[model samples]
Target: MTQTANRFHRWFAEPGPRPPLGTWLMSAAPSTAEAMGHCGFDFLVVDMEHVPIGVPETASILRAIAGTPAEPLIRLAWNDQVLVKRVMDAGGKTLMFPFIQTAEEARAAVSYTRYPPQGVRGVAAVHRGSQFGRAPDYLKTANDQVCVILQLETPEAVERLDEIAATPGVDALFLGPGDLSASMGRIGEIAHPEVQGLIAHAARAAARAGKPIGIVGPNPEMVGGFLGMGYTFAAVASDMAMMTGRAVEWLAALQGRVQAAEPAAAY
Candidate 1:
């Protein structure tokens, strides 16, 4: 079979002058995914970690994003091999494994994305990932197209960034501010100076390891700060966050509590 380009992998392998920006999709709605795809994001992450997006729903979401220029990334709930194989067969190319704390866990996450002598991903003769058996040479080429992104969500994880980044098949690194803050005993305080300090340190560590790093924040301002700290990619909030934030703002305006401001552009 012919090889398909994995843009997420290519973007990090040889980054452009501008860092690619993305957003999270927690609604698990195909329409929402399609709409976000058209909004000019470099990539869109279909969140399976926090949201109830099963394999079938994930397949539908992939179809929704296929027509747009944006790349689709799947954030798995955990570093489970079974979960990884299922989502990959459902057409997930770029996957983000969450809460990884050690080099061994990082290696396991990468192995889940590969098949045969390289790694152990269960094989299937017919599946969406193989174009339903149409891609005769998919087995040989899929490994090259798969992108593995490991999430460092705790102080321990951040401290081991160098070793984890050194693991083969780890295409990129993502620092989860929410979980990291909580792990640092600063829950709901991602902007706390201590948490922010570790974030900056992780970025520099990733740069030193010669790996591209990514992060997500609750707003553009915070994400902009991450970009300035040497993050190669960043995601600003999610569809649900933006929608609810606007809803609250408009309701406050209607109640005369405050004036509603113009909608901020979603990166």
Candidate 2:
């Protein structure tokens, strides 16, 4: 098997007709993941941060996404070297590290994805990343194929956006509004003026650093706002959130308590 370039990285390197739109996969079910992959999303984030997914389950999810047009982006639970090595060995080419606060932390995250001399990733000759040792050039080419997206979840992290984006091997930046809100003493109020200002500031900072930035919103309207602010990519809610929100809407309509609202534009 010949090694291929990471589609996530290539997608940003070469601009598409429109920015890629994606959704979160918090279900932790391969069947659910495969089903969502066929829904025409540009990518599906296999979230290991808040979900109960482990290395083995993450590998299974990656396999499920292989047959779809969407690329799989693994969001690590934390910025740990062991976890990074395990996921990369399990065939995760694109990774999102959460809660990166400093340029050093961003550099550390990048190093974890690289092999010796370039990084400290432990070697494994016969793992899924190397196609079970069938791909002769996997080791040599893996570093370039790995796309590292670091998440900035607080004001402190956003303050170092330029330094973080300048770090070699960091491919993209993500702003986590939920945590940012909490850190600002306004839990559950992502729409607060202060939070919005910070998010917009981060977007400008990312553009200045010449790095692609991404964000996730609870609905299409919010995501659209982020896109207007020059976010290169954005995810609109999660599988569970969409499912539950629709269920509640239908329940309300069936009982005649309220009329069903017009469907919001996707993407």
Candidate 3:
């Protein structure tokens, strides 16, 4: 495959003048992925962890995203080497490994993305990551270019934020606001002041360790709060949220029109 800069990795290593913003891709639709790519997001998370989207479907979504400027960062169901290998071979330059509650799990996640000596990923010269045997130095350079983002979903993960952020080969840290809040007995209450405080604290820990942090929220307001808290990258919403939100608005507006018409027709 032909070689190109890893946009996600570049942003993490040296964020430019503007903050990078992204969105979640839980729709599992290539059209949806492609539409989001053109909507000016800096990146997108192809959510495999909870979306029921498998590797094959992810590849199609990735392909759809490949046509646009926004880069794709896939979240795996787990930090297993097999899953990492499959995602990497399927041409995912950035991988987000979720539910990593400890530094050791974080380290293992990093290892799963790299080849032997640096990681445990098996070499595959003929893989899509190598551009189907086209990226001449893929084997030599893939390790350096592939970005690893570990997730923080529980209180335990937050407590170990410093160590996890400092782990070698971890390109960045992503906070999962939903699960983190759920773990705190505030299920589905990411905006709960206590949950927000924890997220802010995690941001501080990551910043102190000199690591970049990323996070997601259901809407722009919540995501904006996260951005204000020193998160380098933030995802404001998901494909599902955007789609259904607009659909709901449409129904409400149409209902209002019908209600107004009924009153006028009573004459």
Candidate 4:
């Protein structure tokens, strides 16, 4: 079996001049995954945190991204060993953990992705990640090949940001705007002065520790700030947001046409 370099890992190892762009898929559908991939995104994060996607369904999404250039990643609901192993085995190269608040949590998240000496991920060659029972030596090199990204979403996480960034094997740190804002007692105020300062500090801490920072910002203005702050990886928006925004736009235009036609019909 030929060895293939994981793009997710490459992004961290050498995140050149410009940070790579990504999008989120929370609907857990293969069609969305294929569309996001074909749309020229560098990566697409299959969000399982709030999505009702099971392991098998996630595998289906990964399969849809198989022939595309976009990298496949997933934000597991929690940092459990089973979920981490299952998603990775299903071909998710980058695994993002949510609500990580300490260095130990970061370590555990990263360790779960490795095997033995490095981590506790069970060895399984009978999965699609190993080429569907083809590459029998996946366990031997997978530990070093996978990317582990931990999220800093709470005030506690920001307080311990340095320690988390210093954790070995932690490839990147993701900033969760909504959760972090809520945690800071400023619900829905992701753009608040205090929230912005914390985010900036977290990004700097990650950079100082030699790790990349990632974030989920949809609006161009917000995303631009994250990129300008030197976040190496960031998501533009989510699948659900895209659908809702377009639907609203389409419906408003359709309603206007219908109303205009009603006035003309009286003549």
lDDT of each: 0.93, 0.93, 0.90, 0.86
Structure candidate 2, residue pairs in collision? none
Residue-level lDDT of model 4, residues 147-173, one tens digit each, is: 888988998888888899899998888
Report the lDDT tens digits of candidate 3 across residue range 1-267: 368888887787788987798999988999999999999998999999899888899989989999999989999999888988998999988999989989899889999888888889988778778899988878888898888899999999999898888889988999999999999999999999999999999998999999999999888888888888999898988889998999999999999999989978999
22-74 in candidate 2: lDDT tens per residue?
99998999988899999999999999999998999999999999988889999
- The worst-scoring run of ten residues by lDDT in candidate 3 lies at 1-10
Clash pairs, candidate 3, are: 1-131, 1-134, 1-135
What count of clashes does model 1 give?
A: 1
Q: Candidate 4: what lDDT?
A: 0.86
What TM-score, over all chains together, does every model reach?
A: 0.94, 0.94, 0.97, 0.95
For candidate 3, give the lDDT of residue 93. Answer: 81
Comparing 3 with 4 on TM-score, the higher-scoring candidate is 3
Candidate 2, residue 13: how far the Cα is off, in Å: 1.2
Q: In model 1, what are the clashing residue pairs, if there are any?
A: 1-137
Write candidate 1's Cα lDDT for 1-267 as tens digits: 554699987788788989999999989999999999999999999999899978999999999999888899999989999999999999999999999999999999999999988999999989999999898689898899899999999999998999999999999999999999999899999999999999999999999999999999999999999999999999999988988999999887786632333233232
